[model samples]
Target: MKQSLYIYNNGDLKRKDNTLQFTTYEGDKRDIPIERISDIYILSEMSFNTAFINYISQYGIPLHFFNYYNFYTGSYYPKESLLAGQLLVKQVEHYTCYDERLVIAKEFIKAAADNIYRNLRYYNSRGKDVAECMKEVNSLRKKLDHTEFIEELMGIEGNIRKNYYKAWNTIVNQEIQFEKRVMHPPDNMINSLISFVNSLIYAKTLSEIYHTQLDPTISYLHEQGFRRYSLCLDVSEVFKPLIGDRLIFSLLNKNQITEKSFTKELNFLHLKKEASRLIVTEFEKRMKQTIMHKELGKKVSYQYLIRLEAYKLIKHLIGEKEYEGFRIWW
Candidate 1:
């Protein structure tokens, strides 16, 4: 399993003949072998030339960039080396056909809703008073099968999220008055953390999709839009509860992250550099953690689960199998 390389220091990245090197402004250097990296995340200001881009492209490693506010900018996706023309056609066909699209879209919502309920249940079991939220989410989840249009499905998902977010106050040990979900400069620490961590999940999903034959732009749950990988958004909905949300809960409950993690002067919108690094460190560890996979009859890392979701989508597209979005069985 190659690791994701995260650059947090202001430096110059250069291609060192089959390897990569980062030189800080303070006159320090560190070398990284190309083979050890699956992808690169640039979280600080960095300068590089076309040669550096060309080198990573040859190895099929993507680069995810973030701005000064710790918000996701975009990704440097290499040209797809595993392109399947027939599969691409099927992907678009599913998106164009409303009935087919609804089937997959509903599955995505169903799995995501199930995972959300599981989170509330887990916390409720731990003595958190989220039982009422759990009831609301469970009630909304039952309506997934009846949703005939994408718009209707999205409405239910929104309501489920609304109820889920309400439970966060009781779930976390910290007394951060988290009300509703907010974006475009998240209003509080919890919202800022959600935006930052969810972006990481989206980037991670994009990297997983790049390895498969599926086109990331053609999606069922989210409308296809220019300059965006909507397929990642669709797939990320299934795993965010299990991966991103749980991680946030743990970080706050254990005091690993708190209000001090953000710059108060920036309206708590800017995550301090050290805090950002700590979040990424814990996130990487979470990705590498493995669980027993009953279907595979062995253990698989959490990161590989995203890749498996892509493979499952491919199977559904190629008529090898019927698509069923991943629901946590454990």
Candidate 2:
């Protein structure tokens, strides 16, 4: 698999004759072979001419941008290559039909809640005293099947996640206090990590969707709207608990990420460059790790697991099989 090329310094990006080159403002330059990159990430100040943008577009490589706060800003997505008009129509049908939309939406919530339960159970088995939180999660999750409307289903999903977040406080070290899920300048260290890592997962999901036939803008769980790819948001919910939150728990338990890694600017809490880099490195490591997939009967990288999920969605759209959001068994 090609790796994601991350640019995190002030630089000028330009084409280097079948390759990509970044020249830092300080006069340091590095070359990245175009064939070796799955995507590109612009994390710091950089300037690139139109020639470079048009060049990468030829390969359909997505460019994800992040602001200084390590918060995801947007992406320069190239035109979709896997544009199946039939699949697009089917995708819209799924969203337009209330019962059809609700089924898929509820499936996403069910899988996400199950994955969250997996994390809590893993900790509880180790004697973390998370029984109270687990009880709340189980109670809320049971409502998924009974929910009649998408709105009500989402309510249960929200409550389940809230209880899941509360369990984190008991699982991690006492030095870090994770009272609840907070964003809009994430008030604490754990919150900052949550925003930063969740953005990566979202971007990663979008990139995987680009390779599949399903339209990213047509989604069920999240209302499809302008200025955002909502399908990525729906697919990402399944993996965030699996990939993002699990990594967060591990980092905190091992003290790999500390409060020192954060900086407060006005009312916003942002991660320092070193801290952001550390988080990305750990995330990349986790994506490269493998698990034995019983259905596939082989080991697959966590990154490929995401692409497989996309393929599963496409199959569901085309009526080849049912779409069951990925729920972790191991």
Each model's TM-score, in the order given? 0.98, 0.97
Q: On residues 1-330, what C-alpha lDDT tens digit does candidate 2 reach at each position?
A: 699888889899999898889999999999888888888888999899999999899988899999988889999889988889998899998888999899889998999999999899999999898999999998889889999998899889989988998888888875666777888768888888899999999999888889888788888988777238998999998999889999998888888888777775433377888877888889999999999998999999898889999898888878899999898988
Go through the candidates in order and give the C-alpha RMSD of each one to the true structure.
Answer: 0.9, 1.3
Q: Which ten residues in a row have the lowest lDDT in candidate 2?
A: 259-268
Candidate 1's C-alpha lDDT? 0.93
Q: Which runs of model 2 end up more than 4 angstroms from their true locations? A: 265-268
lDDT of each: 0.93, 0.88
The candidate maximizing TM-score is 1
lDDT of 2: 0.88
Once superposed on the true structure, which residue ranges of model 1 sit more than 4 Å away at CA? none
Write one digit per residue (lDDT tens) for candidate 1, span 1-330: 589999999999999977999999897999999999999999999999999999999999999999999999999999999989999999999888899899999999999999999999988999999999999999999998998899999999999999999999999989988889999879999999999999999999999999999889999999887338999999999999999999999999999899899999989999999999999999999999999998999999999999999999899888899888888787
